[model samples]
Target: MIRPVAVIGAGPYGLSTAAHLRARGIPVRVFGSPMVSWREHMRAGMLLKSTPVASNIDAPQPGHDLIDFCADTGERRYESDWDLVPVEIFARYGQWFADKLLPDLERVRVVSVDRAGAGRDGFELKLDSGEQFTARAVVVATGLSGLARLPRELAAATSDGLSATGPFSHAAQHRDVSRFAGQDVIVIGAGQSALENAVLMAEAGAASVRVVARSRGAVAFGDAPDRQSRLRPESPFGRAWSLYGLTYHATHVRRLPAPARHYLVRRVLGPLGAWWLRDRFTAGRIQVTDGRRVVRARVEDGRPVLTLSGGQGAGRELSADHVMAATGYRMDVAALGFLGHELRTALSVSRGAPRLDAGYGSSVPGLYFTGLAAAASFGPVMRFVCGTEYASPRVARAVEVR
Candidate 1:
């Protein structure tokens, strides 16, 4: 019997990996909702931080890029992740890619995954539907699902669902920005998500929106690439480049010292918005309180209140109907609760992320990680859609077809 290699996500990395494996005549199964992050998590009318060329999900076959999708569907192309062509078009592009290459893609959530088969060689998977399955190997490409990094102060007030009017939420919670219409909002963090979400809430009719970040000064966008500037070479990481070495040389990145690899992933892409979002966000519309940090948060009178520490002083109090944390994501392997304790314990970790090899495999054989989770080993490109071009084929070859 040819035991299938299970791909645990249906996003860009998941779909691309499965496509590559199938092209190699390796039996594979892909699971999870297609493009859930782009379709539900993002705000309406939000633009992508990446350029049109950088947003493609890779596949082994040629002509499967975004240009082909635009030709087939007649979807209007955009200059970047935002503007006229919203994220909706990109989500549609992912689904179109799935339909074209991954016809048997399983739109289901994996509940748990643990060691299975001889010598704990294979994997046992339980789905949300209570169905059980086994595979020769498992690819953990669960994109940013459990990696949301929320401030401890606001953690108490945060909830995944906005069943009733909510006090706070994370940008990754997939909450609809329209829900906060006519309500005051406080968006935390100094990155693209924070700035863009603030702009989105203002457009969504939030009564008032304010951005409070530990970084100083007004909102700043990254430098656009020009002949004179080499630091801001055009790539998926946007304004950021590989200060350590060649930007896309992910293979070279993995062989570097642990500290160097970590530094490249963290420092290379710090908090900065896209060049195009500059005019969209201004001091007049979304009030900015830079050089401030949220020290404590509590709900008073059915509203979320935050105590600020930095910037001015420690006694500052800011209240809003809701608070949103765009603090960004961290690649922590422990946060992936679906991996049973025994399996997680056996898997090696570095800096809270799975320590992966050049082929994207973790310490445990037959198990692999990709996407942002693989950023620690593969460099920051794993955080973007175009990274699939580099990652998918490597992971496909790494997973054995038994």
Candidate 2:
């Protein structure tokens, strides 16, 4: 029997990889709800920082790009990268891509993935619905599951000795911010997610919202390109030549020394907000406590009190009804909790992320990872949708040859 290859996610990377594998005539099974994170975790009315042109889920063949979906669905067709794309629109486009290219994708959750057994060269996946199957290979494309980064201090404060629930939460935990209405919210982080969520909470009627970041300067915004500048098309991320090279030449990035590669991944696309978000973040809407980091947090009278120090000022205290840590994600291979002990033990890792080869394969043969989990090996491009353009076809080719 020809064992099927398993793709364990239905987001951009999973969909893109599945399309490439199928195009190569490789038998594949795909799992997970298409765009589940975008549809559920993201707040309503949020706009994508990425522009229209750079926001496509790469398909092996033509006619499945975001522009194609927009045209086919009669959605507003954006003419350039400067146009801000809405999260809802992007989620819809993903669903359309799945329908057109991978309609057979199974929408079940994978509960566990273990080695088939001694001398077996494949994996056995157990599904949430009590179904089980063995695949010749498994691609773990699960996006940010279990990877949300909560600071040690904030995490300790929020826990009741049992769970990290109540009064504190990660930015990715909310689909709606209105729940914080009339409450004081202390938003931590200076990145787009942190800035955007602070604005969102204030807009949702939060009594007060303040942004705290370790950087002393005000949050920076991406520059709007002049008409002359727009003549040269912008990369999906931005117009920087470095970004274009990073997006296109990811293989070169993988070849660099581990430290250099990791440093480039962290610094290349650092933190900033979209130009469009600036207007909403003015003093009238929100207050920003720049250059401060939360050194400690404790629950006081059913609220979160943060002791912050850094930047130029003396340490200070801020009390808020709730704390929102937009601290971002950390790629830990253990976060892929479905992997069995032996399989995870067999793979090599760097800073908790799987160490991947040129083909995005882990140390274990036939076991692969992509998307955010592949960032350590592939570079920061793996963190964005555009990474699929490089990862999908390359991984498919490797799998086909194997």
Q: Residue 215 lDDT in model 1?
A: 68
Candidate 2 residue 337 Cα shift, in angstroms, is 1.0
Candidate No. with top TM-score: 2
Provide the TM-score for each candidate, comma-separated. 0.91, 0.95
Model 2 lDDT per residue over 153-245, tens place = 887875463122478888888888888889888888888898899888888899999888887785777776553255454566766677777
lDDT of 1 by residue, 330-377 (tens): 988788888999988998988898998878888988899989889888
Maximum-lDDT candidate: 2
Each prediction's Cα lDDT score? 0.81, 0.86
TM-score of 2: 0.95
For candidate 2, the per-residue lDDT at 121 reads 83
Candidate 1: clashing pairs of residues: 47-81, 47-82, 48-81, 48-82
Global Cα lDDT for candidate 1: 0.81
